[model samples]
Target: MKRKSTLSRSTTETEISLSLNLDGSGIAQINTGVGFFDHMLTLFTKHGKFDLTIDAHGDEADNHHAIEDIGILLGKAFYDALGDKAGINRYAFQFTPMDEALCRTCVDISGRSYLVFDVPLTREFIGDFETEMLEEFFIAFTSNSKMTLHVASLYGKNNHHIVEGIFKSLGRTLKDACSIAAGNTEIPSTKGIIE
Candidate 1:
C-alpha cells in the first residue's frame, strides 16, 4: 500500500497545506514565500527521496509563523502517513559533510517528541532566512511528529554550509528511519505498538 498523507491547517497567522509520500523518489514542490526556506525544503525532499508538496502563505509581516506552521504541517503529514509505524526500521542516523561543514542527524519514530540541536552558525543570516528560524522549524517539526530527532554540526565556518549540511543529514536520516524492512509487517517496537 502507498504510504501517503495530506494535511491542511489555518490560523490567523498562516494557511498551509502539505502532502507527503514515504515511498517515493525525492520529488518536491514547495512554496512558503521564503525563497531560501523553500530551497532548503527542496533539498530535504531530494536528499530523502521522498515525494512532497507544500503550499504556505502567512502574514509577511513576520516569516516566523509561516515557517513554523509549515514544519508542523509537514510533521503531521509524516505521522499521518506512517499510521501505526508497522514494519519500519524506526531508527536512523547519518553523518554528512558539505565542504568544510560536518553535520550529523539521528531520528527515532518512537511516538515520543524530542529535539536536540547542537549547531551554531558563525554568520547571522543565510539570505532572507534568519539563521535562528532553523531551530524553530525543527522544534516545530519534532513536536508535531512525535519523533525523537538530534542534530549536531560538528564543525562549520559558514552558516550556509552548516545549515545545508544539517538539513540534508536530517533528510537522509529520516528516510532511513522510516524505511520498511523486508518481511516485517509488524511494528518494530517490543511493545507491539508505537504509541
Candidate 2:
C-alpha cells in the first residue's frame, strides 16, 4: 500500500492544506508567505525523498500561527501515513554538514511525544522566519505525531547554514526511521505494538 495523506485545517489564526507521500521522488510545492521557510521545506522534502505540497494563509503581521499550524498538520499527515508503524525501522539518526555548520538529528517513532532541541542560534531571525519558532514547530510536530526527536547543532557560526543543516539532517533521519526494515513486516516494538 502506498503511504500518503492529505490534511487541512482552518481557524481564525490560519487556514492550510497539505498532502504528503512518504514514498515519492522528492517533489515539494509549498507556500506559507515565508520565503525562508518555503526554501527549507523544499530542501527537506528533496532530501527525504518525499512528495509534499502545502498552501497556508495566516495573519500577515506574524508567522507564528502559520508555522505552528503547518507543524501540526504535517505531523498528523505523518502519523496518518504511517498507519500502524509496521515493519518500519522506527529509529534513525543523521549528521549533516552544510558549509561550516554541523547538525545532528535523531528520531524514534516510538508513539511517545518528546523533543530535545539544542541548536545554537546565531541570530533572532533568518529572513522573515524567526529562528526561535523552530523549536515551537518541532514541539508541535512531535506532540501530534507521537514521536521522539532530538536535534542539536554541534557548531556553526552562520545561522542560515546551521538551520539549513538541521532541516536537512532531520529530513534524512525521518526518512530512515519511516522506511521498512529489511524484510521484516512485524511491528518494530518488542511489546508487539506501538502505542
Candidate 3:
C-alpha cells in the first residue's frame, strides 16, 4: 500500500500546499519564505527518509502564523496518509547528537494529542526565525495530528545544534513509528483500535 497525501490549507493569514510520502528516499522540495524554517523541514524529510514538498505564503513580517500553519498542514497530511493506522509500529523514540547538542524525541500515534517540549535554546533568534516558534509549531502539529510527542534537549550549548538535533530526532522517530511490520495485520495497540 502506498502511503501518501497532498494538502492545501488557506486562511486569512497564510496559504500552504504540501505533499508527503511515507515510504521514500528522503527527497524534499520546500519553500516556506523563512529560510531557517525551510532548513528544518528539509532536515526532517531527509532524516525521516520521506519525500516531501511544501509551498507556503504567509505574513512575512511575522513568521509565527506561517510556521504554525505549516505544522498544522503537515500534521494533517500525516494523519491522512496513515489512514486507519493498521499494521503500523505506532510508537518510536530516538536520540540524536550534533556537536555538543543532544536531543531526544518520542512519538506515539495515538488518537489523543499531547506535546511535551523541553528544549532551551541559547539564543533567541536563528537568522530572523524566532526560536520560540518551534514550540508553537510542534503544538499545532501534535494537536492537529492527534499524536503524542515529546521532545527534549538533553544538553546543548549552540542554539542551531540543539534545534537541528530535535528536528532530526523527531524525523527519525516518526519514521519508525509509521513503519509497517511484516505480517502485522493488527494495529499496534492492546485496545484493538488506535484513535
Candidate 4:
C-alpha cells in the first residue's frame, strides 16, 4: 500500500500545506519563513527517510501558530495514512548525537496520546524560533496523531545541537515504529485494536 498523506490547515493565524510519504527516500522541500525551523524539519525528514513537503505562511512575528498547526496537520496525516495498524512495528526508540549533544526518543503508536519532553536547551531562542515552541508542537502532534512520545536530552550544551538531536531521534524512532513487518497480518496490540 502507498503510505502517504497530503493535508492543508488554515486559520486566521496561519495557513499550511503539508505532504508526507512514509515509505519514500529522504527528500524534503520545506519553507516556514523561520529558517531555523525549516532546517530542523529538513533534518527530521532526512533522518526519517521520509519524503515531506511543507509550505507555510503565518504571522511572521510570532511563529508559534504555524509551528503548532503544522504539527497538528502532520500528526493527523499520519493517522489518516496509516489506515490500520496491521503488521507494523508499532514501537521504536532511538539515540542520536549531534556534536556534544545526546538525545533519545521513544514512540509508540498507541491510541492514547501522551508526550513527555525533557530536552532542555541553553538558549531561549534560535534565530526566529523560540525553544518553548517545540513543546507546543509536540503536544499538538501527539494529541492529533494519538501516539505516545517521550524525549529526553541525555547531555547537551548548545541549543542547536540539543534540539537537532531531539528532532533527528524523533524522526528515526517514528520511521521505525511505523515500518510494516513483511507478511505479518496481525496488529501489534493485544487488545485487537489500537483505539
The lDDT of model 1 is 0.90
The stretch of ten residues in a row with the least summed lDDT in candidate 3 is: 120-129
Question: Deviation in angstroms for 186 in model 1?
Answer: 2.2
The 10-residue segment with the lowest total lDDT in model 4: 119-128
Q: Against the unseen true structure, what C-alpha lDDT does each candidate score? A: 0.90, 0.93, 0.93, 0.90
Better of 3 and 4 by lDDT: 3
Runs in model 4 lying further than 4 Å from the true structure: none
Residue range 101-177, candidate 2, lDDT tens digits:
89999999999999999987969899999988899999999999999999999998999999999999988999999
TM agreement with the true structure for every prediction: 0.97, 0.98, 0.97, 0.97
171 Cα displacement, candidate 3 (Å): 0.8
Model 3 lDDT per residue over 119-138, tens place: 87767799968899999999
> Looking at candidate 1, what is the lDDT of residue 125?
72
TM-score for candidate 2: 0.98
Model 2 bad stretches (over 4 Å)? none
